[model samples]
Target: MNRSSSSRAGLALIGVTSLVLAATGAPASAAPALTMTLSSTTGPGGGATIVGSVTANSVTPVPFPAGTNPTVQFQYVGTTAASSACSASAKVVSPIVVSNLLTTAGTLTVNPAAVKRISTTKIVFQVPSSPYPVNDANGNPSTVNPNGLVLMGGQTSSRWSVCVYDSDNVTTSTLLATATYTLAIKPTITSILPASSPAGGGQTITVNGTGFAATSVATTATAGGVALTNVKVAANGNSFTATTGPRAAGDGLPVVVNAPGGTVSSLDPDNNSQTNDPPIPFSYTNGISITPNQAAAGTQVTIDVIGAGFSSLTFDAGAAPIGSGAHVFLVKDAYVANSNRGVAECTGVSVIRDTELICTLDLAADQLNPANSATMPGVAIAEGAYVLTVVADGGTGAGGSANPTIVSSGATFTVGPY
Candidate 1:
């Protein structure tokens, strides 16, 4: 009799469970019979608008009534299960609890609303940042799980889902479907090359970093708070380029890159690494060109160098119009072959205009003539193919050794046998 009673109790329990499920209009078994998908898996911190649609396969799901459209209720939770909540199995509930964090109405307008079903519902809604939880399925508010972790403080991701309601209203609603997605991560910038350019802008700069999207529509590069132009991203997505916008001289503002995920500034550590993005070193000049293409050895020749950014320096414009303590050099082609053996370091650089400089090359003999030593007589030039490099030092004294900030570009010239 005892064994029979036990068997009967087991049957009774199963029947009760089935009746409870039937009354709620929910399936007795949890299966992915209803498929749900979100338009995108990632978005910004404020939130992202996600469009979702559901399709039913084997399940003969519940149909929404004619007067009532299906509803999509969103929930921000710690768990990934479509049918379960974070607070369900825990012996102690977390500090965070949310229900119905956000909601959207199904809009498939068929002649008869009654014919509309969960599988046919389509809805759009936004998912917000974390630390703030959303309402649970029961339409109750959720709070942070004190015993768990805090996610909203950084570029972190949390599980978000939308549940399809059999009825247009959330109250007394039956969950027919749910779709899960991961929150988007913020982008980071590591470096910007050609760090500084003329204040006039228009320089093509290269930005290197991680988490950059594939198109300009998804990314923006800026200098001194001004937006750049012709922005292009690399195939690897690790770098991008943009033409700088005009700005005043001085240490121009930080370079910045903005994306849907997040904004990274030159002020931020490189890709969140320990290093910082190098500052933009703006100036009044940029290029160099030497006049009188060629000269023979032993000839006293004066060459004119033209370039911009030679004038209107930001600070330390001591004595020279180009700025105080600035030094310019006409290094010889030999310097390229070997710095130590070259006599290319031409001295006595003279500034003729903010944008121009004059250098005298003493092709006379091999060494400085004591009578003209003060002019720092130029080094002897050999016959053959050679190029001269123009180096500008924005510092005090020769070579501007005091302050090493230097801007240089070249002009190639040849010397014939004298």
Candidate 2:
């Protein structure tokens, strides 16, 4: 008798689970039996008035008694979910877009004028193009709004499911159909100046575009899988400047740009309408630096020169006195003559990736010129700061001979008495 009772208990539990799984006003075990069609998939500002139709597939009939209309509403959550947001909320929040930012914790607020029942299987919707009162959704008093993540925070897009409910939202309401909408505004790029730069980065590039955030930290840009640093947008929100990071020389690499976004809409599809989706033909040369810069002159010790695009810098025989028209020099801070520089001791070269170089450079006695060693005379070596420079002919994008193939970045190396 006990065994029979246990079997009966298990069947009872299964029936209870089924009823909960098919709860009304919420998602059910059935797949979305609805499809939403909009005039366009993208638009500017949550302020846009989207005219769309929600059609049911295998779902229940939305009862539209000649004078009655079922509710057609939007349920939104961060399209990009985060674990922290589930437990903690923001301490401070910004003002949000009024039209489309709805919350789940309070009374569902939707203007009756926004929806119209055309048939049994479909309902037409016209989202409010004008602003709604902020207090309407928060019960006219509460400050907490779940949709704030997209409207007031940094999230670019919130997943919105256009839900169709038969009659009022209650335990018995039949959920007909729901679909997620994809809306975006493409940021236009007018141009990217200085068309080309070294793959090893450190190049300051100016990107001109419209609809920028001006001073917001959300504005960012990248090229060739390398991030842009110190990104600052113009006060007018039309242009910005940033420094590039290291990247290997390649034929094609994606150029990405981002701006302050996430209000009733997406940050963007991240497509630049002007430059034809990533302006092409970027030129790269070579850039490198050295480590442990404080070394005495005439020191034959192994010196480390590290930076990116070093593979573009080569010697016929990675050997001492790399004389393949490739030269590394430690030019005096007050350089006046050729001898005012030290022919860096690059006795050996190591290769792995383009970002670093474990090579040897001879720190010969650095000299300084009063006028010219041939004119007034010069000092054998000066103990001061010197800038490291390289001459890599035929580098990655080494443009011309008059300018050499590589334009290395300036790295300071201090020199002392031998």
lDDT of 1: 0.49
Span of ten consecutive residues with least summed lDDT in model 1: 103-112
lDDT of 2 by residue, 1-418 (tens): 5999999999999988878877644654633445556554333334344555555344434434456665654444334332112111111222334444432221222345666767665456644333233454556743433332223233233444455565444455555554444323335566667645565678898877665554212666776657779988877666778887876555444456765432211112235333324344344555456687677766655656655656766653433332344545555442322234233334456666767665554555334222222211333445677666554541222231223233354567777774
Q: Residue 36 lDDT in model 2? A: 55
200-235, model 1: which lDDT tens digit per residue? 466888888765656323677777776789988877
Query: Which portions of model 1 miss their true places by more than 4 Å?
Result: 1-43, 47-127, 131-185, 189-210, 214-218, 222-229, 234-238, 241-255, 265-293, 297-308, 313-418
